[model samples]
Target: MAIASSQPNSPAHPWPSLVPKTGMIVTLLFVLLLLFMLDIALGSVHIPLKSVVAILFGNETGQVAWEKIVMTIRLPKALTAVIAGSALSVSGLQMQTLFRNPLAGPSVLGISAGASLGVAVVMLASGGAANAFAIRQLGLGGSWLIVLAATAGAMAVLLVVLGVAVRIRDNVVLLIVGIMVGNITVSIISIWQYFSAPEEIQDYLIWTFGSLGGVFGSQLAVLAGVVTVGLLISFSTSKPLNVLLLGENYARSLGMGTFSTRMFVILATSLLAGSVTGFCGPIGFIGIAVPHLARSILNTSDHRFLMPSSALMGAILMLACDIIAQMPGTQTTLPINAVTALIGSPVVIWVIVRQKNLRASFS
Candidate 1:
């Protein structure tokens, strides 16, 4: 998690010039609203924007089916996209700041993999298989069960990573350990898959592909609650994260306890990443990409600005991805993971190139 500069705005550092924060924030909010409405309107049914707005405001849209679709299906899905997007992006921002690495993301430490492992246990493990029929029969209750399993799995891994983090001084080594742990978790999932029934394997596979539509009603409420708590934790640590950007020794010199701060960050990230994975499956790219996007757009490293910017940008991106996944007028829908990957891959390449430029400028 160490980087070269121990001072955030040092004279020799090559950070980008700051932009007008207020303007950018307002723009992001407006875009988020636009995309939210668009995501609801452009689904397979193509409900008119007017009707969507009308239904949202408690007015009769005349078409009962449109009202039901907007209120029941698309609205919940859109909200899920917003919540999940912000959760992952904020988690990524915190991780990147903690590691002082542009590529650090929620998945980087295998937290998402751990969550998946939890889901795998429920969906594919021998004991889970025996109760699979009953679990599905439980419907929304079953979904909550999976959410709990995923959160537990994520925390199980977080505990291991934190245990290692406390003993390891090197961020790079901790990163390697996290990756190794994640790989081991994936291998365990694979072993479970191999022995499970084909139907069970298929169910687990769908979960990996991810879906925002799966969360709604009481499920949406739970996801929202979890994410709100995580974001508040992340936001409260903005000052600590800033000091950390100056390196651990400097942070300690400033009266911050390095160990405690690190633990809090890891815990906050686990809650956000773990809960989102539990509810929406493991969403990729946004966690790794949105922070960089926010940093670049905002042109500063201040967590105060970066966190909210990342959240709004993430929500907008997720809503856009969801709309594309719906394929608009077509009944066919693409996997949200696939859509995010397609869009996120390019942003990552840009990040690499930008980092290279930063290095060259510093040299």
Candidate 2:
């Protein structure tokens, strides 16, 4: 009888190739840190980089107004953008992998539509009353009720999509169904808008434009907690996801529970997408485009590397968009969603056009 070998290059051990991957990881981390600092420092109000660091470290000798600007406005907005970007990008990657479609994303699948619907109900239905007395009676004062409604909307759509995905085997058909769901949600929102009061409609329109500044300091802890929990869940599933890349039957043969894994992915996507859309409005393009960007940069689909790289890339892209939204030259700030769309859409179209064998490779 031959003894099983435990040598470093044995079949079980394989050749250790950590050095290159580790180097890539470290490089990505450094780039992410640099981008984050730039995001915080380069804004409408130009503060010296050293002064920005000092303000962050509790050195209050700097200009009192500059400190207020950093602490109150730019820092929180930049942080929110980072969190939202990371969460949306990861969720999009998971959705694409789960559905095995390049076009899969929260907005495409009506997750954002669900969030919009929730906001519509709160702002249009509940808060539509002419008098303040009626608004108070409906419990729509602060943004909390709207957030709750949006969350409920997102979960509802997620549940529907999960059910559809299970029954529908063809990836193309599932993608179409997701788009139809989004259209249906848009129709609902349109009806609400038509009947909504002008004041309420104007408010809803502003929300639709999207703004990271909508999230206040008080709400940051809750947003961070939700996003952190969802991210951990996604990271934990990387191994199974790698197996899943081999197809459902192969994954099952490897002892993976396809149904449970799919359910968890749906749940995580819902939480991440729902929370961000609820707090920050239906941010566009980051989810749909960031994963592809990360994959193209890394030139590998291995989830172990892809997941974290996508997260950092998403954060960086989002922070950069936020910085752009605050256009340094112009007095008026642009909408966050518009900035993401302008940047993300061109990249997405380029990917579709340039990757000649994209569909064939997936098939």
Candidate 3:
């Protein structure tokens, strides 16, 4: 990423100051590292920080049980947290920039809801018998099934939004269309749940609560791969995204294809948000809250900086939340979704309150 020109009179939209933000960016990366190690170190069973470090470096920890917990359980969980946080945060940043709305996010736009619906169709809408039949006979089970279904569902919603974007120039109207579409998706899922078997409902409910521990091995690899692609796609759009911020008409004047830009963003968002929802469930707040935090800290709208900044901030926040949800030193654990809501709700309120007039935020 190009650093903002140090020259004051440069005509190009100035990027955030490099000197201060570089330090902040480095600090955030340091914090992410600390949190990753901390998330692995703290759990229901206490493991010494030294042992955790040793195990990570392939040293013999001497205690097999501690080693197993660190390597098999905590390591994957912590990695998943980083991936999920970065994916959701960057996806949110893209959405906010694309829609030019402070509140625009995957969850807010119903993209996650759409993903959940796709999973629901596989896990809940079909009778347990048919689902089992498909899994056993067709070999369509496990992580791959859910991830594909979720991605498809998210893509479906994205297409609708894109269709609306083509004809409607007003962002407010587009935002409302997204919300209404998402609500419809949620309602459909609710009705399916109402008819689903109790056991099926229970399983789906657990998925909704969200868990970083659920992904491991091949599943973890898949999540990481998908999120990485999404992040790259978003990063590639930094220049176009900057032009987009000046409004579509100005963007068109500059020979940018507004529709094509929107397509790239939606595609990236689907991969990022959908894969996370499929593996980790519909994680909220990280997407909506992290971008604002990055913007506030960096004091610039440039996507090049905001993308990485949000990724680091999002990972930090997610790891911190995961630590809390684990309720270390106790067997009792809280749902990640609940903890995220507790944290994210206040941030949303802050965005609204601080903006005062919502429309002015985009302007």
Q: Among these predicted structures, which one has the highest TM-score?
A: 1
- Candidate 2 structure, TM-score to reference: 0.86
Q: Rank the candidates by TM-score, best first.
A: 1, 3, 2
Task: Show model 2 residue runs off by greater than 4 Å.
Answer: 1-20, 131-142, 162-177, 347-361
| Alpha-carbon local distance difference test for all models | 0.85, 0.78, 0.82
**Residues 260-308, candidate 3, lDDT per residue (tens digit)?**
7877887888888888887888888889888887776776677888898
Winner of 1 and 2 under TM-score: 1
Q: How good is model 1 by TM-score? A: 0.89
Candidate 2 lDDT by residue in tens digits, 1-363: 012232466777675442224466678778777766676777667777788888888897549998898888778877898899999999998888877877788676788998888888777876425542354444431367767878888877777887898997654576788778878888988998898788787767877888788566667778888999898889877888878878888888999987778767777888889899988888989997888877766666777777888888889889878878878656778889999999778876787568644464367
Q: Highest lDDT: which candidate? A: 1
What does the lDDT come to for candidate 2? 0.78
Between candidates 2 and 3, the TM-score winner: 3
Residue 276 alpha-carbon offset, candidate 3, angstroms? 0.7
Better of 1 and 2 by lDDT: 1
In model 3, how large is the Cα lDDT of residue 167?
92
Score candidate 3 by TM-score against the native.
0.87
lDDT at residue 256 of model 1 (Cα atoms): 91
- What value does the lDDT take at residue 105 in candidate 3? 90
